[model samples]
Target: MRKVVGIFFLLFSLSGVTEVKDAHSASHTSVLLQSAYESVEPGRSFNIAFTITPKEGWYTYWENPGDSGAKNIFEWTVPEGVTVSAAAYEAPKRIPYTGLMTYGYKRPSTVLFTVDIMSNYTAKSLPISLEAEWLVCEEECIPQYGSFKLNIPVEKAIPNEAAADTIASFSTHQPEISWWDSRLIINDTSSALTIEMSEEEIKDYTEAYFFPKEDGVFTYSAPQTVVGMAEGLVLNAERSNSLNKPEQVTGILFLKTAKGDHQYFYLAPTLETPTIPKLSQMEDPIEMQSFPLWQALLFAFLGGALLNLMPCVFPVLSLKAFAFVSAGSLSKADRHKEGWAYTSGILASFLAIAVVLIALRSGGDALGWGFQLQEPRFVGLMVIILTLVAMSLAGIFNIQTGFEGAGQTLTQKSGAKGAFFTGVLATLVATPCTVPLMAPAIGYALTQDSITLTITLMMLGLGLASPFLLLSYSDTLASKMPRPGPWMEKVKQGLSFPMILTALWLATVYGDQTGQLVHLFAFVTFVAFLIWLREQMSSPLKRILILGVTLAFSAWFLGVSEKAPDRALSDQPSTSNVWTEQAVSNLRAEGKPVFVYFTADWCITCKVNEKVALQRTETEDMFKRNAIVVLKSDETAGFTPDTLKVLKKYGRAGIPLYLYYPKDGSEARLLPSVITIDILKEYIEGKGV
Candidate 1:
């Protein structure tokens, strides 16, 4: 439905709509104005949150003031250099009282608004003023007001720890685009509003509900239906017939996962119908990691360290290198600061991966490393982001956002994003390492419990982070380095080309996996439009909206796309035959030498074999010359009951399985799951394994 923005934007925009609210002590509540920033810098923006704390046993109202309570109001009196965004309120808990339903806070609460400080302000300190009014209720209602002013000092606009934590606590309840392939069934004849997530992700949640911030869309009193299974979940809410059917839909989805309850803000992902691609093309790569903890740790660390010098991580490395050099000189303290920051960023990124891995393991998702590149849409999104970053690096448009800023201007102090933030993102983009090389290590970790998995992943992170951290902190490195200057600019700009190349590589991988580029190209255009829109947005509020929406879309799209199938690769024509006991026995009975192989769509090892050996023109020619029939059995979407029986009979149940039966009726030979082209050629040439 084309609805008003969620409670977040509406809450901030309500500044002038209500009568002035001033400080006052009432029967059950009090009001006060506070800022999240300790001080404000010119040209920067900061948050000023309203603390509408009530006495014990009392509650305050939501922005919509659902059903009965009056909405809180605010008026601002600020310094001439200051401007404020419309107000924003935290998500409220649903409270049921004496035959009425209300959405509000029971304990001390906060509502926030943005304040922008003009760049021209020369004042050493500024007076900020705010007045507010709210209603507090238990069985009865009480009106309250407060007037507060604070002289905030003129200093670097650093964020305050407590204020950020407070905002995050309340904001966690807001709905966000955390799911991909999500849709709002707008024109459906069914009375319920339906939402769908990928099968792999939805099964994790047991209960869900959509809360419409605006009125007239959904009946607050109507029940919600939640259907979840191995594939995904579908949530339904009754449509309000009194209101016209919304062309689009927006609301918060309250979800309960293993981590507990959360409000994931759902902005419309796309109006198009989400396609259900086939299952994964390769057997999961990470599923093979079954080493003991010590071995897993050692391998993980080695794998991580190798990533630093890998071609895929080149772009990130260049950014960090330039940032380090531009600093020119660093004292002992400076080295310590830089080392810790970069290390922290890497570890955080690794932990995030662990969380997803653990959750998917618990939920029964058969995904491995590098599988993310299989999704055309996801690869396309990465292309968009990378292209934007390249443009920014080449001076096409300046990106003030954090991702691009991590490598930002090398001259900027401590590299705004520096090594730390870049390390996190870089590690994620390091998809190449998750395959054949690291597969055994990662796979072993995946099979173990969460604790072992987490420990193993941390080792990997430490290995990847060690080089940068050590380089920054070591005094000897400074003496070995060339002095920083204009030469650095040439290197910085040159690095953009490699990033663009990486983007191209991603696009090629997308085409290989999906065999389609329509969606990929479309997403690039969408990203360009948003970036252009951001450039044209002179107003801070406009910029915030554009940024928030774009980010939400990116996050949701990537998460969903990662789970999509590889249609082109998994469903492609190949020279191998599908395996079945009857088919194999019949061929052998016909006096034909038969070659049998087993594979699954989700097996990365299977995919490599397909490309390198089975699909080879020479291999097919040899099969024909020798009158050998090639057979293949697919287990991409997991094994069916019949396939399971076949697997068990073969003395092993996993892929890639290879068996050779000679025409002379000699016993069949079983080959290794991972076979080399040379070895396969030897077998085809009558050499026994």
Candidate 2:
């Protein structure tokens, strides 16, 4: 911690002098090379970013510069043994000039690439030489071209915080993703190339535009309708303006999120239909689904209301309870104001998560609710957060909002902010668990229009916040609270137990996600040592040293750890069969009823339903009596693309998906997300409740 604080302060000292030199040709547009690190470490991979900023009203084109602008071209002259990757193009913002609509940046944007250094190169100074050219236009196009150089002294220096901040700001130009899918509709008259994905993928934008990779394939300025479909969302693009079509269409789809977050999608749709082996997928592609908006709203509200009871949310409930109890001295109006603020914070967080979800999903990233929990890195971070929160609650730290120390009194405004922060924390912790009511609503929200999605999420937030809001505004509830004193301190300290438990749980989850008990537990021990070291230290220097080492170690570990080895299906129920379409086919050929379960270790609901339904003796007997075959797939520690493909085939984004296939050769039935023993029995009986 002491070392970390020292480095932080050192970086802060350098912030003023971190010079960035821009290479400009006549000032219409400027290009700059900025190092994201203080020094280029030997044999380490780091980023050297290119920032393209156009003067007011002028713009530079993207790689696929729409109808006519020239794409930016860059060449580098580097020392031998150095490997530089191709540029990671930032999503281009729309640049409309004259009568033509072009694609590129009108403001500042960045393109980053990784530079790998060779171990053999031990030089003190390494020169970075580069030449770049691009077409910039306001009314008329100007071909701006230039050469630039930077001499980077090789050293084992830390990351540059200022350059990092700049990189981060420019990095938003990176694309947000959703799953990638091309839905082709074949009819007698003509075939339409439809791209179907989650509506949340592009829900933020009011306009839909496509820039084809191959020229003459798509009409550059032609309008495309972004509509919500049953499968999720689709961009029904207009054909070429010249009535000409390419054999295949491929390019980038750009959308500015409701929050002004730019997202890009690299769409490459095959001219023909796709085939997934071992799966008989959904057949229809063009019949766009129009789910009624009212049903989604109702489900969303119900799901949010039930979210409070989830394990992911329970640990944070104490904080909201404490906030409510702490509000005893405040007047009714003040309490009401705090409640509104708290509610707003939750709604804001949900909205932000929605925007992020849409962006990433649109970018072809396989993401969903509880996705962070699926990541070992995220689980590790949660461990750190819970540990610090435990320490704060146990009186180890006097954390405050804009206040100096314990001697200072907190104003009502700060108190309200704390309440708001607690609400935010509650929503964050609640994300990992798909409780009974929330699964449908969360699933539904991802498919709706932005307004509907936001409204749906707001309903969810209201449900989560409603109970506390009621308490916040209630004078009667406040009257029931014991006064804040020594007991309050004791209660706060006691609250630390749950936080520690949560930290432990998160640590265990990290192990589960990685399937490396040794490494994860060792990592946890290191973190524990740091926490203990902080408590034992009176000298601030020693504390920072431990904190810095721990953090740096964590950063290094997450950066280079190999993927976790695959987990076997040995722990599955003895009666449960291994899941495979071939197995199902064989069983059905033999006239046996089959029940298929799709699950993952990261899914808490999967474990619960596994214990409550499939593992039950009565359920087993019912299955046996009906001669049923139970098949389960555990997609926990490795890349099981087949599992993911099967999941997608079932119209599911993630796990705990249950399907019942009767031997009668009837259509398969989808079991509810939260299935009861009775429901499972009815499903086996071929009559769903």
Candidate 3:
């Protein structure tokens, strides 16, 4: 009966969607699967798109989702004589929150995969099976399982007009190698590289991203850029602070261009060159190896330390420690028991998080942190929780759980439980705090063996819970607390300020994730509901009713609502253009100066550059004065054909790249991924209009 009631309440609480399980849909729900194919021959690669439309608010994972979530499972049941390789993915955007990360498509995103069918395979009917597993979500995420079996015929003659049109469209969008200046000059002494190009290719390109083929060489986000004389660009790549000089610097060069993205690959053999320029060259492609294990563990430890400082953990940890310290008459042994209990709580929470993450990863989520909070409804729920905590601390209500004979109320008798629960709550709240200190550690942990992974997570938990543990286990610490007095009330009320502050921060985050209007509406509703709940009798039935109301509101606000707003470029220019190497080359060939910026939508360095350099008034003015074209190539989706071309041409693949081209048809000059006002001025002055 209770289960039935819960189910009924869940069904009744839903908004913005309806579920139908008809006889036909019992075996398979109404799923829209769109498939398109292209041919890959010399100078061209085929682009294919397999779109699976879920019943809205459903998703699939990327290659990695840190901590919790399932990986998107796909099986190919192909027809005879047809060989297919894994589809290359466009670089993905990173979303970080708190301590957890997940990577996947947020909206009704189409998964684009490519196929290289030999010319001989044309005109043949291809039998294929597309078996996929994904997570369909609207609050409570559900795993979806299905397989698509279809026989698509291949044409022997030239592709039909409609097919040709579709193929052409996909091909145009496919990633390809673009124009790169063939000359590369590397200064090992100063750790700099310069490439000369036409001045007209880029105007005042900034915010460049570079993907170094070799790891531990150049740091991911620290290249200094300078525009040199004539049509050339110079890059001063600082050697990794932790290591000596690398044998060679290789990767993709992503720059900004007017036509959208200006992406190129640069693979130049390490050469000792003086002041004169060196001719650039490309080499056979090499695949990168995964990061080693010990390093991953170390990263996890560091990440764990940083997690303690996160908004969620900070409040909870501080409160828990204060609670322990306030528990005056407790013995040392009693305090130790509380410490163990708190540890147990934290460990249990970690286990649950791990299970959820692993399940979602198995189902195919991507590498984003705190993605569960992406919905406004969830954020609303968190706000409600924080508000309740603040109200409770302010003595707005009394919560008693039996134990009347023991003369201890629920909040006093279970200080240990409170501390432990605090740990769990901290984990729940800190999902949006992904930072550089935590990413590599969590990222590496995700790819590790479960034992190692669990240990790493536990270490993180320990780090976050350390303060509470120490406080709980130390009677001496408890003795240090001020004797129970009027000052205690002042401190309690003061602590509520943090809660209020946290609530405000969450509301703002929620607003940023959704629209300001949605946040405002949600806040008004939440405040009104809280006031009403406070007015109602605090009876058992009323408490249950309030819980139901809270859950219902959360579901509606987070689960049934639209996706979060993209706050990446709230202050940036138009996003219509995607830079490509071919486009950059074409602009340069057209005798136009070009400014190329290579960056990932998720890269902090890239974001900073976008704000300070490219978007600056002076930069824009200089670009206009020089009649320079602006281009932005994104590497967040990995390497596209256009991205690959740019990477190969420039002999690079890492991000935060910048390049410049004069109006001449000569090679492009490599600029530093990092830039300053003086650097920009020098480049503009060197290449006179």
Candidate 4:
């Protein structure tokens, strides 16, 4: 039957019949074109409507057919001086079939068009033609077309009462542009359109749904949750996986008032910034808080223990190891004291950081773990401290207290004070590396109370300080350490290189943040000059004066470098586009796969992943072959609110986030924090679990 109907329409379309006809019926539908006036005067406007009646149990589509249908098409041929406006549609009913929701007319529907006749005196008759095409569906879909022609005598206007009455009957069905105050609020995962209405206006409505004119605005199959507010109604809809941030939301809102009475209104609301809720308040799909509090603490402790292996923290741990080797000659009691002092240092430092984070958040700063590194001044201070430590270990300068019995350099001292400061330095450098389990633990901790945050962080610090503390306390562990000897000096000098490398990395972060390489160059040169002066001068008083001057100059330089330049002028990667919520949506709408990686210069793990997986030739080739759009969001400088919202949406508080959106409109897959080539390829190929 479907094939026969298709063949019949195909034959009729090719027949090229030029005879006048006002109505045609075939394929379970009837179409007719009628004018409001039988005759019209020049310079006056008239209404023409195309009335479509689908047979029982069948339907035809509206301008924006939801989910899976095409809209009706119309082509008009009129006189040269005449103007015809596009068709306007009435509000459509929600038609559900075969588990898919669609918008169309199940009964008779009219699409109205306006035509203006020229003012100049013309011929006695005006001929008009229309080629109409539409799709009608019952259990199957069939294409239908009609050729419509009509002639009207050009004379003073004469009303066609029947036609005028037909058009008037459906006029109230058309949606009116709403005058109610409304706004669209969008976050990473969902969107809500809020409309202000009086209590009287909403009292009768029991249900409501928004039908967006634009495709991909919302998931048509997803249920819309509506909440009644004191001022109005908020229709919360699940955002389509492939959608981008819309400039304005244009749609028809259908309200079911009193079951039989339905109201439709048009809405075009502008986007407004939404107030992001606390992490605990969000209904995150990833179930970030699924694990118990004990599990989170365990994760934090293990993550911190693993952080000792990171490049940024290893140099400081190496220094502590050297101190442990030297402690072999010291009394067991002194070693125990040193271990306790170091533990205290680690716990105190973590507590201090927790306090500061809590205070800043209470003041409404949207910060996360490792947020300190985002500040240029803080990065500058780390660079200076690391550089000085490197120079001291390299024997360029000695950090002496200048008291009678305090002649030993700081790094060479095996006392409790030196060990304590080493633990503090270790904690400082460890912030930039986010290892496995660390992101979820910290994300959970930050959402907790102050006391919980402090305790979780203390557990992490305990893990970091465990190895050296155990060595100091246990005789067996102490015996395993190499004895201090002349060779220790060469080993110390070798360790200086790692400190130098760490310092250089931090300097790069500084440059990336401040966009001022000249300042870094000058600071390095100044430090070199100070090192030279210390070696050349023998007078203690002059040396003290030089040290004071260096301190003052360093302070001034760090203060001056805190002012960052405009980010637009900063250097960024040329190969990838900057990540934005809108750009990602637009690309997805174009049916292109997208790979977006969130990174930062301060994040060592992100840099490692980029060098090992993202920057490889095979990865580039795969991307090019697949026509994938790659975007990079650098948070080294600072995170935009949208970026932060995205992070929170994925249950993270920091970067090294990798997301792969498939071209087939599947939910975006979150890649591993530490990605290898095989892992990335697997995710891109839809083979990941």
TM-score of each: 0.44, 0.53, 0.44, 0.58
- Best by lDDT, which number? 4
lDDT of 3 by residue, 147-252 (tens): 4544444542233233344344434433345345533333332345545544554344533444444444433323334343354455554432234455655444
lDDT of 2: 0.66
Output the TM-score of candidate 3.
0.44
What's model 4's TM-score? 0.58
lDDT of 4 by residue, 44-118 (tens): 898888899999988998888876678888888988788889888989888865324689999899999998988
Error of 3 at 4 (Å): 94
Clashes of each: 41, 25, 137, 0
Cα displacement (Å) at residue 599, model 3? 12
Off-target runs (Cα >4 Å) in candidate 4 are: 1-291, 400-414, 531-540, 567-576, 686-689
Q: Can you rank all candidates by TM-score, best first?
A: 4, 2, 1, 3
lDDT of 1 by residue, 32-126 (tens): 45567777789988877677778998888878665568888788888887898986766667785422356788977778788898999999886
lDDT of 2 by residue, 1-689 (tens): 54554344334333432333334434476666777776776888878888878889788777778656887788998888787788777777666432235678878878787888888888886677666667777656777656666667788756867677668876665665536676443222233445565655535454455566565444444334445454644554333222344556666666555464556777776565333211123342332223345666776676777778766677788877776676776778878877888888899888887777677767866555666566677676777767777777777764553111111343468777777777887887776566555665666566555676677777888888888888887777788876655566767777788878777866666676666657766766677667677768889899788779878987887765444665455753453467887787777778778888877665667767888887899988888888887888766553266765555444454567788876764335666767778888666663442
Residue 268 of model 1: what lDDT?
49
Candidate 3 overall lDDT versus native: 0.52
Better of 2 and 4 by lDDT: 4
